[model samples]
Target: MSWAEVGQRWKLRLVQVDWYLCLGLLFLLLVVISLSMGAWKLNLIVNDADALPIEAVAIRGERARTSDEEIQVALQDLMKRSFFSADVNQVQDALEALPWVYQASVRREWPAKLKVYLVEQQVVAHWNGDAWLNIHGQIFDAPKRSDIGALPLLAGPEGQSKVVLTTYRQVSELLKINGFKLDSLSLSPRHAWHGSLDNGIMLELGREDKMARIQRFINVYPTLVKQSKPVAKVDLRYDTGLAVGWENAQKESQ
Candidate 1:
C-alpha cells in the first residue's frame, strides 16, 4: 500500500483504540457511582457480611466521676456499625461530649473490636459560680457536690476563661510566697479585678496593670501587715501607693 494509505489506516486504528478506552472508562465510572449511591443494594449486603463485624468494644481509662455505663451509652450507636464502617472521630467526639470527659481516643482493633481510651477532666477550680474549670482551663458543668465548694472560685466574662485561669495561677503563686491562700478571684464587667484571700482579706486590682499592682502589693505586704493590724481590704489602683481598709481604723495609705 502507498505511504498515505498506510498512514490513514494507522489513524483509523488509533481512533478505534481511543473509542474502546473511553467506553471502558465510562463503564468503570458508572459502576463506581452506582456502588456509591447504593443502587446495587445486594453488593452492600455481601460486603457487610464480608467486612469485619465489630463484636465487642473495650474502654480503658481512669474513671472517677464518669462511669463505664455512661461511656457505653455514648457508644451505643457506634456499636451498631461494623468496625470498618464506624467513624473513629465521631465516636471520640461522643465520648468527649460527656460532662466529665476531657478527651477520648477511639481505634479499631484487629478481627472485630473497638478500643476506646478516655481522659476525664480534673477539676481545678469553680468557674462562673456554676461550672468547673479543669486543669487545662476548659469549663464544664456537672452536678454540684460538697467537695467542689472547697475549690478556689474564679469568675470572668464569657470567652475569658483562659485569661482568668492564667491570672489565677499567677496570683496564687505570688500570694503563696507571702503565706496566703487565694480563695476566689473575680473580674468585673468594667474589667476591674478583685480577689479574696483565705484570711478574709480582699484585694481590689483595678482595670489596667492588675498583675503589676499585685506584685507591688506583694513587695510591701510584709511591712504593711506588720506595721498595722490585719487589714480587711487593699485597693491597689494607685500608681505609687496603695489604700488599705483596716479592720477597725479608717482606710490608710502606704
Candidate 2:
C-alpha cells in the first residue's frame, strides 16, 4: 500500500480502540449505579419501623411467683419497636427487676417474636423480718404475704446473708436429727450467733466453733429434758460445758 493510505488506516484503528474503552467504562458505571440502588433499597427495608413488628413474647421456664401482668408491664414499651430494633438486654433487665425473678434471658425468634426465659427466686427463709432469703443465700424483698410466715426467720447485718445462711443450714441439720426444728437464727453486730428452736428453747452460739457447740448441746439434750421444767435457754459459748436455764428461771451450769 501507499504511505498516506497506511497513515489513514492507523488513525481508524486508534478511533476503534477509543470507542471500545468508552463502552467498557459505561458498563462499569451502570453496574456500580445498580449496586448502589440495591443497597439503598435494602437499607430502607431493614430500617423501616413498621417492618417485622414483634407481636408476641413467649415466656418459658417454670414461673410460679412471676405473674403474667408483671411480665406485660415490663415488656409493654420495649416491644413496641420492630423486632430488629428491640434490645434483648433491655428486656432481660426489665424481667430481672421483678421481685420474684432471679434471672432472665431474652432472645429473638425468626420473623417477629421474642422468647423470654425467666428464673424465679426460690425463697427458703424470711430475712430480717421484712425481706426474704433465697436458697442461694441472696436477699430479695417481696410483699409480706400470709404464706411466708411459716418459713424460718434469719437475721444478720448487710452483706452477711451467705454466712448466716450457711450457719443456719448446718445448725438446723444437727438440730433436726434431735427432733428439733430451728425456727429463727440471728447474727449480732458483735459477730455472735443465736438461734431459737420450734419448742421455744433459745441457743446462744457465741462467736466461734458454732457447729461443735451445737453438737455439744445435742449430746446433753436428753439429760436436760429430764429436768422438771422445760429448758428455756442454753448458752453454748463455753469451751467444755454449757449453761442451762430452765423455763422456771432455774439456772444450772453443766
Query: Per-candidate TM vs. native?
Result: 0.73, 0.82
* Deviating ranges (above 4 Å) for candidate 2: 1-41, 250-254
- Clash numbers, per candidate: 0, 0
Best by lDDT: 2
lDDT of 1: 0.85
Clashing pairs in 1: none
Error of 2 at 39 (Å): 4.4
Candidate 2 TM-score, C-alpha based: 0.82
lDDT of 2 by residue, 60-176 (tens): 999877889999998898877777888899999999999999999989998888998988988999999889999999999887666454889999999999999998999999889
The segments of candidate 1 whose C-alpha lies over 4 angstroms from its true place after superposition are 1-53, 145-149, 219-230, 248-254
Candidate 1: RMSD over Cα atoms? Answer: 7.1
Per residue, candidate 1 scores C-alpha lDDT tens digits across 1-254 of: 89999999999999999999999999999999988778557556533734656788888989788887987798887777766677899999999999988889989888788898888889999999889998888889888766554889999999888888899999899889878899999888888899999988889998888878888888888877796587888999999899988876644333
